[model samples]
Target: MPHPERNPFVFSDARFRKFIGSVAAIGAAALVLVGCSPSTDQGGTFADDGCTSVVVATSSEKVNLMEDLGAAFKDSAEHKGLEKCATVHAVNVASGKAAQYLSDSTTEWALGADTAPSVWSPASTVWTNRVASIAGDKVVAGAESFAKTPVVFGMPESMAKALGYPGKPISLKQIHDLIANPDGWGAAGKSMWGSFKIAKTNPNSSTTGMSMLLMQAYAASGKAQDLTVADVKAAEEFSRVFESGAIHYGDTTGKVLQNLADRTSGKGSSYVSAIALEETSLYNYNIGNPDSHTVQPGETLTPPDEKLVAVYPSEGSMWSDNPAVVLDAKWVTPEQKTASAAFVKFLHTKKAQELLPKYGFRPTDDSVDVSKYLNADVGVDPKQPAVTLPQPEPEVVSAAIDQWAAIRKPSAILQLIDISGSMDESIGDGRTRLDGAIEGSTATLGQIRPTDEIGVWAFTTGLSSNIDGTRVNGIGVVRPFGVLGGDKEGLQSDIEDLANSQRAGTPLYDSISSAYDYMKTHAEAGRINAIVVLSDGEDTDSATRLDTLIQKINADQKEGGNDKPVRIFAIAYSKAADVESLEKLARASGGQVFDATDPAKITETFQSVMNNF
Candidate 1:
């Protein structure tokens, strides 16, 4: 049941009160499978065929859990009541991607299932509510939450202790105070910890990150709920300050959690000190599933040596009621709907509900004790998270998402493009490797804010190289660094020219080292400094050693004490590209490595890398 007191602010608002009253009336009735029907009664009678298969589309975070539940359904005897063997097929789709599929049923990825999905279980009800608002009665008309978890700061136990956590609830205001201080955690006697690197998903792409944004809005307004457009506007400065501490913004929290788990010590080696995550993820981490990837059948989890503790903010936080919605799409048959309902019922069963605690989730069934799973050993307090922030209307969430890019930390990025002879090869789409790289990269420039400092570099071995008196191994720079405000067109022209240039051997090593040196020499304060390199070939003609270049890059990063370290993002362009070396370069600078091996994904992959800003 939705907490009435915790959500009072949303209910009390005049607009929301009216909206909820009308929506609740629709939700109270079980809608039919046929799309856009005025009647809310979903009751249907169908002859049991003795066997039915239902496809369930789930969010990435719950993929493993859903798989386990699916296996359980297949082996359960309680399902005999339907006189049908219900085959539950679970597909893991990211929340934002699933939202898109719901909007456009013709989406290519959704077609992978033998039949259309009968149910859609995103990580949070926020998504269920979103689909309802967009598609109206034609989409998810009703949903049942199976498990409950709240958003919390997942940090190493030692760091939490230093910040007075567990003993005291850490507030966002306290976090902001630390971010504002240049000394970072060093002000609190932990100088080696360096800057307070926080990790969060891009709000537009993630449920957990979206909840974090709401928390920030409430913190700025000093309210537990009813976040307004005015509140979002007022919170812009605070949001920027808070966002400045983010080392990287991924599409999901798994990457951040995995990075934290990789280094058990949770010191300078770890990319992030704290990450915004659902308690389920922290639970999974403590149990040794760092990546939280899909789990195969009969697999047993091996707990990790390092544990991540949840720090519920004193200001307030949001609870994710992981709702499973039986989608009211045209493809859902009466038999399938009945099967889906059975599966939902099975999830609430005592046996199935008992599995929730073992996976670090609070079961929705009242019979299961929340205390059994919520304990300090796994890094959560059974009695805490006393406050649940009220959710604003969906429109308010949309507004906050739109405002993020404007208030996010500015970036100083240098994109290094490789124009080797191999780039002239075809990618089978009537587009050459160079052409795809140019077109894809040019499109990404538009997403960069005008205030950001940007530049373009195209490197090939024998092209009036910039090795004059500089380093003995400097590769040619097609275009130098320029501010995007006035040089956007010029940079685009340079990118296009790369496609038309006469190809030469790739100077991968020298070009990378030279670009790194250029950015390091011109590193700007108060902005994220980064280098994005797209290469389709290995070093064919370069005097620089890969190890030596990596050493210089790592050494230069250490020179700037607490100055935002310059990160390198590498895109391994094709099958023949050297991914292992690129991964090394990216990891050396605390950045990410993106794969664009499929020619078709070049544009999308480049855009994904831009999300880091």
Candidate 2:
């Protein structure tokens, strides 16, 4: 476990410091990979270059641990009989994004800088299998695991105790029943806790989300493994029931954890009752922080006032075996392959493997003790993960994730887009900010369920007439709230027309209150009722105060009845936009905010936000 050998490149060394601070680019050719350079010496080797680089791409969650391991491997004098010097460089990327690069050859993942990875360490093997299916013979099967962790439900201590925590084991069925219960948490004698809300990540984009959906299917069939297409189809009712309580669906579990930790005490219901995330996330949350991006070395994390305890569902759960895979792509050189294998072997060493426990992960190396990390004080049970679910066929896993959006509850949404003067500003290419929003809106409309009801309202300082010359509150009603099944065309046209219209001043507060009240009154059951606000400016004309609006939303959300919950999804449209206030507004009703500050990302951001539905 001691330092292998003094790092050849010290912190004080210019080359080491420069390489460590390099940023990984997105949507462009990022030079973060290592490629072999031709030898000039008589032995056909470039030993003078110090070592050949074996660049690795690690899943976001494992970035911190992998960074430590990579540094150690690079500094090690000898690793598993490898004779040549080898440098290991680690970069963090989303598992899904990494899989996309491996599956497709034309993808310029990281050009010029580092190139394609010699090794890929995703959070789970699910991604490995997926990439293999797409790339055929290009992927090596059964990669070695360096760290082990499982998906778990993280709930507030008070909420877990209400469901019989220490004495009784909680089941997935029990959680689903709570979601289906008319009185929500009140059914468990906690009316003030309001309705049961679940914060989950997007299945199409997040590993935790994929595992959560699979677990629900397995739980529904009363089986822990061998989930078939039939089993997934049959679980529709269960999936629907469970997803009904979902208040937010983000791209990462870390964001959800941060939200829970933020509103833990007096505002218990501001975020969610529970989050379906990695056990590692729960461990991190209880230790006072949620995001590893902000974690500083030697900084002691302060525990939250209300700790989050991990509840291993009685049904079963999947382990995220952080697998280190050496891809068999054409870009991988023989020297790079050897170096990659050496690094993998080095990862199994006690020195590297022992770091897992400190990061809330179960070390894959059996020699490491796990008892201390899984104690009650850390919000986990040492012996409670009794069932380990099997990884279904890759096809089945894909089907289960693909079917989730279709089977989950429908959404009834009111899109309140800003048409204030700021929207008239150009976003380049002879297009205005409003033009970008219109493009995004049109694309998103195509993805919503046909049976769902949707409406569009354009707001500015003063009210205006509709395309039909009809006026309401001096504002324009582009498309009246109605079923998408019959009015898709009209709605699409109205959204386009909003691009051409312009007005003065941004009446954010009044527009939000009006939309919230309207949606609440016309809220549909068995559907996600929401008010989505797309604004590029702060409140300029409104009688309602921000605090008053927040109180109103919180009260409305907790009023408990047969009516569906109404959430506010705010999009801060530009850099100068007031995101802080928008985020507060969104979280007030247990909703989430999406950033569309960059004009180039407008379409993708809008489409991504719809993943919550």
Candidate 3:
């Protein structure tokens, strides 16, 4: 089907070239990237000058695409023809967070600016459905898909070939069978590769994860459409079995793909055998841009030695139909609404649709051929995923989400905090770095499941007494591992008390090593074992070397025959924190490092880290 002819505005080749040439001159002045802030300035810089500004809050993966489109729209004659010239501004916001912001008017909208979005375009329509369900249908209007990509299991080329991928129809049931087999890859005669570990994101926090969840339900029900609440319940066991094979859950697919690419460089394929992510992500990984960030001009990409192939589940899969929705909120003015509609319409034009394939997305315009980009060279088959699953009703989706919380893999986590003297230094608002971290950690406790095991430990040089009065060196257990259901209140209080215990030097190296040893020793078999380290600075005093700690972590995370996997998630809490060292520790353990260098973002950062479980 050809793109709908809704907007009469059309640009000829000469006019398009003229518009493109003028973009460099006006793009900078017109585009305003908004971040999280509490102030309410719905109209941006253009508002003061009698110009309409349409603020578009979009998912990170498509920020670059939206920014480019925004710039082009700004330069278009249609925009100039408006009674009041308009500027289209694009801001990067995660899909899940955007839903939260939209559902609650009291919530702060942007990070750097006070402006709320006039238009919201998340990676999938499911998010819009969620917002409409929570805030009513009036809140989300005119949701039109502009681009699409199906969710698929991305496996290493060798592994996919072993399963007869292109020749044999691989289904979710087949993958589940492999995971259920105690022999793992041994079932396929590849005894060298141990357990078949899979990587996925937390459904509550990711689009691909949410889509994967829905697909799993459909696969379990043996239907592609009209999935019911009873169907979700009946599939509970099937979903649980599939989830048990997960290596670990995260907030984004980028980290998993990046780690997989890094492992292929030298560390080998011991990290994860397969990952459930969008087809575009697999294409990006095959082209050596796992994170999927826009490649700049003059940038050279080095493809990984072990490229991944897209495995479209024979049971049927769901597509992330990137949709642009014009919100009908009180904050969105009439002029802004008109401008937003124009921009969304422009996104479907030939010029805009032509750029979609270049960015690893399938264009909504059927006339635009995607064969060149989605071909075997990038490890994706353009003709596949022959089956497309429909989105379930909002009620069914809500039920699935609730059911997922009960069946998802539980966690065994240790929170390691730095109470060094430097943490006492003020970071505006008369609050110290330790205060921010404490507040963030306390809030994170609410997000944890009751069945998960959690604990807290504070570290500073010469700390001899723990909360329980046990003697220790540099590290003191504020609370030992216990089920969150019974220990949450006490854990929150202990984490809060950490702010008053700041003293002495930072024994970062020794403390981390100690935490790793403890968690590894107590690692649970059916749960994700992890250590979350939040430190404000580098090691001021420690006998352990960085290389030595890295070697220890790598040895335990060996490619074959390792059962206990305790990942170490590091958080650089302030500008003074040693990001490089923390990154090395995280990478060594097949984990991720989060930067909370701006102390104020600690709460948000902490929540993101907890999503790994």
Candidate 4:
């Protein structure tokens, strides 16, 4: 690049040097443009040519792979001797979230599993073509198979045997029969009851959720005959079977995997449900197995009896191929795009794809077999790559997901705030525990719909426990305070007010106990009632012991009582914050215990709870 001091006319004419120079400047600019027109190098760096970085937005599940894949192309210990190639960033997200972020100009590349991601690869061509119709710009079909594995119906082997697995093949109808066994309907169609249950991933978050919905639709419409919409709608038994089984249905496939893992962990109960989930996640445990044998990396064994039976489902089965997507519109550059492509390529490479097997996911590469990466005892049998995968129209698929979302049960949430003195201490963002509690509670309310009644309760003062004759639980007071009628602005305001004006007390027992009673008394029948309590201190004030509260809550729930037996969640603000208490309370009510010492991260914890709900 060069800057000219004077134009040709300015140097030749002394009279009108300024004017001549201005005129000459135009001439010089035209000459420079002509010279730079693909003839000469007019730019300083080739990076300016727009081939640097490429942003690929993707499902959050792929974020790990994306980062790992990106690192491999750099030639350090992880990527030794490799060129400074394009970077790959996987924009992982919740199930439909990628689709929503894709239309925005910020994310030029969208990655995801199934119809959500527009980039074509694996079995994504059809999805890409369809999204392009509405998304406008056409996407390039990149070459590579990052991970390929069949989606299977996870269940205990004993349960599978009862469903005609050992001898006769179990059809979709049979699976339905097993789930609806305790619940039967002649008009809906039932050959026999296998006495098993059924569950599914949340249609809102997991890719398996998408797969499950489409499968149900196909099965309902009689995919055996390439079911039509009319056929699906006319089949009254369809909704019946789908809704009957929900033993461990979760917001994400990972959550479902944890549910399965937790059940058969040690002397644990097993779910006999025909839960639809990805084989990949089934073997990847956040916590290792009983023996070093199955816990070894790249090792996992099937139970002495293979509880998991792959049911292609008499109808079409769909696979989830999540893609990477970028959302920062202003920041998505060519460099990021290149990085994304490189990342995809790296993932498809032999070394990386091999990691899929340990997680029970089969790789797409032909050079290597999954058995090497799997502990045969606990691994899924994904042979011949899902020989028959049917692709239904996206509209049909979307409609099925929509229907599932609608039919799902509503959530009754209770926010149990710890208003003890310890909450007065400031936790990040310059906000005290009380302030954090209020902020988190109010924000959580904003995320939920009004149909979802979120109630807030605080535990403090002499009402902390069941002392003497009081019905309260521990001193860690957590109860309902603010309640909004469904989703509304006024309701939001009321929740905010409750958060601000909450009375400080050390009697956590009173709040949690009363809130449970309130929910039990007021909750709409059939909703999943749950209470979430956050505390920064211990229970020094509860008059009632934890045992009494648990006993009462359980008894009341078993037999209808005022508290109606609600799920109680315990969230400790820190490690010193009485983990034992939270765990006991949470276990009693089937609620989870979360350690949330930082109020700034309260939103994340709240969101996690919301997802599970």
Model 1: per-residue Cα lDDT over 169-189, one tens digit each: 799888887878888878778
Model 3 vs. true fold: TM: 0.89
For model 2, name the residue pairs that clash: 30-110, 31-113, 31-114, 33-114, 463-474, 463-475, 464-474, 464-475
Summing lDDT over every window of 10 consecutive residues in candidate 1, give the lowest-scoring window.
Answer: 33-42
lDDT of candidates 1 onward, in order:
0.73, 0.73, 0.78, 0.48
Alpha-carbon deviation at 116 in model 3, angstroms = 2.9
Query: For every model shown, what is its TM-score relative to the native structure?
Result: 0.83, 0.82, 0.89, 0.67
| Candidate of highest TM-score | 3
Residue lDDT tens for model 3, 1-613:
1111121222234543443233223212222212112112222343353457778887656755665666566666556556666656556677887887788762445453446788898888889888887888878867989999999999987888878878998898888878878888888888788877888888887888888888888998999888999999999988887788887887779988887877735323477778999998887776556786544433445566666889999989899999998888777779888888888888888878886765579999899988755678677888989899988888888888898888888889999999999888887898988888888899878768888889888999978644334355898778877787866788888888776684999989989988898888889877889999999998989899999999999888874677569998999988989999999999889899998888888898998998888
Q: Distance from true position, residue 504, model 1, in Å?
A: 3.8
Q: Which residue window of length 10 is worst by lDDT in model 4?
A: 32-41
Model 4 lDDT per residue over 1-613, tens place:
1111111111112332332232222212211000001110111211233223433434434434334444444432323322333433233344444333444433443321221222223223234434444565444333334665455675554455445554555566666664555433222232232234455656554567666666666666655435445544554457645654554345455434433443423211222345676555543322122111112122322231133444545454666554332222334445444444445555656766654443345566767765543433343454422334565665655566556655655667777667666777777667777777666666755446556666555566743344225565433323333344544665456555644443444666655666667666666544557777777777666566777887776565344212223666667775557778776666555455665755556765665566555
Give the local distance difference test score of model 1: 0.73
* lDDT head-to-head 2 vs 4, winner: 2
Clashing pairs in 1: 30-42
Report how far off residue 145 is in candidate 2 (Å). Answer: 2.6
lDDT score of model 2? 0.73
- The local lDDT score (0 to 100) that residue 119 gets in candidate 2 is 84
Please name the candidate that would achieve the greatest lDDT relative to the true structure: 3
